[model samples]
Structures are given as structure tokens and as C-alpha cells.
Target chain A: MDVFEAVAEPTRRHLISLLAERERTAGELVDSLPALTQPAVSRHLRILRETGLVEVRPDGQRRIYALKPDGLQRIDDWITPYRRFWRDHLAALEQHLENQ
Target chain B: MDVFEAVAEPTRRHLISLLAERERTAGELVDSLPALTQPAVSRHLRILRETGLVEVRPDGQRRIYALKPDGLQRIDDWITPYRRFWRDHLAALEQHLENQ
Candidate 1:
């Protein structure tokens, strides 16, 4: 599955958000999502891993997972053209921030 | 549906890509996707409209569709943190351009 669909689920998006902060172990990711069963969360992680949006490595008995932001380039590229729609506003905001 | 899922469909994403260039008539959008039936195209447009990612207005006998980029902020905000993962590389490229 493409990264777009992989991150479509709310659970997966939540996982991406978590990994963005820092790398986490399999247990940590599962524990962070209280509403889901470990299996469900594991499935989401697997999809994320398969899509290359995430990378995992064995850390002794634990598996560490982190965001592999390269997969996100597809989304970034898609959004680039649309950014011009609001570029002037964003530029103005940047100007305001520089003056402050 | 949230904008994420709304744009998740490849067809819908294509439509957004087209609209990003400029507002397009309903016929123009439908014509752009040759593989999809007119009804299928209209359905995608309706979902985009209902999700607020796209807005449609009637122009005489035709309907016009345009991207309401504000709806895209959700995707942009979600992507903000992840951009940091590749920011340094992009910044380096920007610096190279500035130097030239």
C-alpha cells in the first residue's frame, strides 16, 4: 500500500504523530494507543513499516520504530503545488514573525 | 470524511492536482480522467465537496470546481513535524540556490 493509504487510518496517523516525537519500542507504540488491542496496533505498524513510512530495528528483545520521513516525500510533493494557493499569506505571516 | 481520506483516493488526488492549476468545470474534470465513468467522477467530486476540500459553483449550464486550499491545512499541519526529518537537506538546497 502507498504511504497515503497507509497513513489514512486515524490509528496510523496517530502512530506517525507519536514516532515523529522520537523513536519508540513496539511495546511503547502499543501502550500509547489505549483503545486498540495490541494486535490491531501491530497490524497498523506493519502496514506503516511495509509502506516505508516507518523503520524498525531489533533492539535486543525489543523492536524500535521510528519515522522514515522519506516515504512522506510523496505527500509533500503532492501538496507543493497547492501551497502556492496560500503562499502569499504564509509569506506575509513570515514577514510578521521576522518583525516581531 | 476528513481531507486525508478525501484525497487518499487516487482519482480524487488527480482531481485535486488538476484544480490546483486553476478552477475547472465539471465537464473538464470528468474529461480529464478518461478511465473513470462520468458518474464515478461526479461521485468523487461530491465526496470532495462534502468534505470541504473542494467547492463547486454553477456557471450557467456548467458547474465549476476549485480547490479550497484552506481545507488542505489539516494535511499541512499533520505534515509539519515530519518535514523536520528532511528539513536540513531542503535548507541546504535553498542555501545553494541563494549562493548562486
Candidate 2:
């Protein structure tokens, strides 16, 4: 799955956001999200790993997950053109707000 | 559907990128994507419209579709924290390259 598809799910998006803050083990992620079962979180993590959004390293018996940081560049690159479009509109909005 | 879900499909992403360039009528979009049937293109456009990614308006007998720049802000906002993480890593990489 691509980053877009990986992040389409709310739970996976939350997982990415959480990993962005800091590295966490599966247990910690599970603890953080009480609504989801451990299996569900694991499944999400696997998808993230496969998509290269999150990299996992084995630390003794526990596996630690960290955001790849550069892994999202594909998505960032895809949106770069739209960013200009947004920036132009945003500048217009800012000017209007200033005029107000 | 959320922007991520709306954009998860490659064809939809292509449609969005195409629209970002300029507003296009349904016929124009259909012509651009010759691989897809007209009905398939119409369905994709409808999905984009429903997701707020693309706004549609009637022009004569054609429907003009334009990218709704702000509609992608949610995905942008969600990636903001990761942007910081990415920036930090990019800075480190830049410094490393300079040292080489």
C-alpha cells in the first residue's frame, strides 16, 4: 500500500501522528489507544511498516517503531504542486483579512 | 470520504493533479484520460466532488471541475507534525553533505 492508502484509515493516521512525536513500542502504542485491540494496532503497524512510513527495530524482545521521516517525501512531493495553489489562495485570503 | 481516502486511488490522484493545473470540463478530463471510459471518469469526478477535493459547476452543457485548494488542508494539517520531524532530519543530512 502507498502512503496515501496507508494513511486513509483513521487508526493508521493516528498511529503515524503518534510515531512522529517519538519512537514507541507496540505495547506503548497499544496502551495509548485503548479503543483498539492489540491485534488491530499490530495490523496497522504492519501496514505502516510495509508502506515504509514506519521503521521497526527489534530491541531485545520488544520491537520499537519510529517514523521514517523521509518515507513521507513521496506524498509530500505529490502535494508540492497543490501547495503552490494553496499558497496563492492563502495569500489572497490573508490580504482580504488584512483589508478587513 | 476524507481527502486521503479520496486520493488513495491513483486515478483520482491523477485527476486532482490535472485539475490543479486548470479547471477542465468533463469532456476535457475524459479526453485527457483516454484509458478510462467516460462513465468511469464521471464517477471519479463525482467522488472528487463529494470529497470536496474538486468543486464542479455547470458551464453550458459541460461540467467544469476545479481543485478546491483548501479541501486538502486536512491532510496537510495532519502531516504538519511530521514536517517538523522531516525538517530536522533534512537539516542534519544537509550538514552531513556539506561536511563531505
Query: Against the true structure, whose TM-score is highest?
Result: 2
- State the lDDT of candidate 2 residue by residue for B41-81, as single tens digits: 99999899888898989999989999997877777776766
TM-score of chain B of 2: 0.89
The lowest-lDDT stretch of 10 consecutive residues in candidate 2 chain A is A77-86
The candidate that wins on DockQ is 2
Q: How does each model score on lDDT?
A: 0.87, 0.88
Tens digits of per-residue lDDT for model 1, B1-100: 8788888899998988899888999999988999989999999999999988889899999999998857787788888878978776578778999999
Model 2: per-residue lDDT, tens digit, A1-100? 7888998899988888788778999999999999999999999999999998999999999999999978787787778778877788999999999999
User: DockQ of candidates 1 onward, in order?
Assistant: 0.44, 0.68
- Strongest candidate by lDDT: 2
What is candidate 2's local distance difference test score?
Answer: 0.88
Inter-residue clash pairs, candidate 2: none
Candidate 1 regions off by >4 Å? Answer: A88-100, B88-100
Span of ten consecutive residues with least summed lDDT in model 2 chain B: B77-86
- Pairs of residues clashing in candidate 1: none
lDDT of 1 at A40: 94
